[model samples]
Target: MAQIGIYGLGTMGSALALNMAEHGFDVAVTNRESDWIAPFISEAGDLAARLHPYTTLAEFIAALTPPRVILFMIPSGAPMDAMIDEITPLLAPGDTVIDGGNADFHDTRRRTAQLAERDLHFVGMGVSGGESGARHGPSMMLGGSAHSWQQLKPVLTAIAARYEGAPCVAHLGPDGAGHFVKTVHNGIEYVDMQVIAEIYSLLRNGAALAPTEIGALFADWDRGPLKSYLVEITARLLSYTDPETGHPMVDVIKDAAGQKGTGRWTVIEALRMGQSASMIEAAVGARGWSSEKATRQRAETILGGAVGAFDGTPEVLAEAFLAARILAYAQGFRILASASEEYEWSLDPATIARIWRAGCIIRSALLDDIAAAFDQHLPQGQLILAPQIAQTLARCIPSLRQVVCSAMHGGHPVPALSAGLSWYDSMRLGHGSANIIQAQRDMFGHHGFERLGRSGRHHGPWWD
Candidate 1:
């Protein structure tokens, strides 16, 4: 019998099954579309030796070792529910079902409880690094009980990416924690990509540089503190030329971007938790705005455009990018900390950082510093308050200010960067301008306000 079973043959599912097979774990594989099985096995090359393909669900379930470990890489919502309903009766006590998709944490939590009533285990796992990473090694975040972890640890550790000899995988918490962490990871990714795009706009429009020049600049940035998988890929993207038109590949691509709702989910959850994720919000908003390409074009024609130039050096731009990146990450971490408290999951920012340092889209050198900061136990769990991060901010904030100011003058929209700076400024203020609003609220809505010295709620003199 196969050691484990995977019930999907899409890009991710196929790659993951091959990854397990290559690692010497016989993986029984099946798919909703039975035709996909033969093509997948044929493409597995020599790895097919360890792959046992089953076309039917019953046979697939029967092929796995007793107390079967079945991983579902299908769509997260109704599809997952439907699959569970079909598979639950086939599973025995102690059998585990893993949802290896980008699922909402709330749904994961509900499913976890639902499956437990039947004496079965449910694991919501967050897998990152895309197709190539799946075939080799991806960062894996698992949320389940101790028993489920014990059953899957050996296979997961072998297939996961490693950083400094340690697997970039962990049993984060129970039920929804892993998926929640992945949602935030994607949220941060949205801001990261948006910020880079904004910088590219500044370089292309304001600086009047060619795509190859910008690509060279990004390649250089990849060798420095800004080094990350995204930056590396972006450099290659900008440098590549379209075979048809001979234009830069990025130049020929449409401006409109698409999303899969994880970023919006992150923003919604942050608002529900009463925490600010302004950078992510800005990124999501920018994506929405990008989709209305015709509207943007009409607005540009009606409103005209700014004609100023960027006076900053590449070094200054890099510094500004770094500062904005740090602020965005700080906001994401705050949301994670808030969710941990609200859910009683005790999510570790340090462990999250360490795991993200490799095999993830947002993996970067900055995560090392973030991990170190959390290791020191940041005050109030605020990443911005960490001494090392604070010092880096001190050095980079001025450059960020210069970039934002220059971009505004140049009529370039840098929403994510601007939001990051605004959040940072708001956070550093000891006193804010909200007292007048509070007094107005008391006058109009009869919502009482507390006086500076007094403890109990007090009314403002405006009512008199």
Candidate 2:
């Protein structure tokens, strides 16, 4: 009998199964289409001996041992729910069902409760790293019952990406925590991508740098603190020239960026939790704003302005780039902290950082520093405000301020970068100007504002 069951055979699912087979674990896979089985088995080649392809769900479930682990890599929402409904009857009392999709946390929480009614364990496991990572080693964030973790740990940890000999898989908490963390991961990813784009825009439009030159800069940065998959890929993207026209491939590609709702969901969750994830929120808004290509084109023609040459240097911009990224992570972790408290999940921010150190799209050397920072400082304080992080930001602030000012002067829309700076400044402010707004509220409406020396709320007269 197979030790584990894979209930989908999509790119990620097949890759996951292949990973398991390569790691010397027994895996049984079934897909919606029966024809896929033979091809998948054939593709396994030498690994086929450890892999089983079942055309039927019954045989697949039967192939697993007692207290079986079945992971679903299907689409989220209604399809995931439908799959659960179809498989619930086949599952034994203690059997586990894992959703390895970009599911809404609310749905995961509901499904966990629903599955518990029948004594079946429901796990919302967040598996990151694209197809290649799935086939090799992916970062896994598991949230569910301890029983489910006990059953699934060996397989998950075996196939998970490792950083300095530590597996990238962890049992985060109960119910929807895994999916929630994944959602925030995507949110941070959105901001990271946006911040990179803003830097590219500043380099290209503001400094009038050639694509190759910009690509070289990114490649050099990749060797430095900005080393990560996204930056590496971006460097490659910039360096590519179309065979037909010899123009940069990125120039030939469509300008619009596509999103899959995880970022938006994160913004919504942050708002509901009363946390300020402004950089992420701005990134989501920027994508929506990017989708209006026609409007942008028309507006550009109608309202044109001559921009002066950028007074900023690449070194200064790089400093600003890193600082913006620091703020982005700060915003993401802050949201996570608030969500953990509100949901009562007891999430370890350090572990989250460590898991993100590899496999995941947002994996970076900064995450290693974040993990260390969390270890040194208590979770009660902001990650950016941690002594070491704060000192670094202090050094970068001058350059970041210059970059933001230059971007504004050059008429470039660096929303994520601007928001990051704003968030940083707002947090550092000893007394903000919002008190005037509070006084305004007390003047018109009865929403009270407390006096500086007093504790209780007091009404104020604006004309006095």
For candidate 1, the lDDT comes to: 0.93
Q: How does candidate 2 score on lDDT?
A: 0.91
The regions of model 1 sitting more than 4 angstroms off are none
**Most lDDT-accurate candidate:** 1
Residue pairs with backbone atoms closer than 3 Å in model 1 (clashes): none
- Candidate models: Cα lDDT each: 0.93, 0.91
Per-residue alpha-carbon lDDT of model 2 for 112-210, expressed as tens digits? 999999999999999899998899989999999999999999999999999889999999999999999999999999999999998898888778999
For model 2, state the Cα shift of residue 338 in Å: 0.7
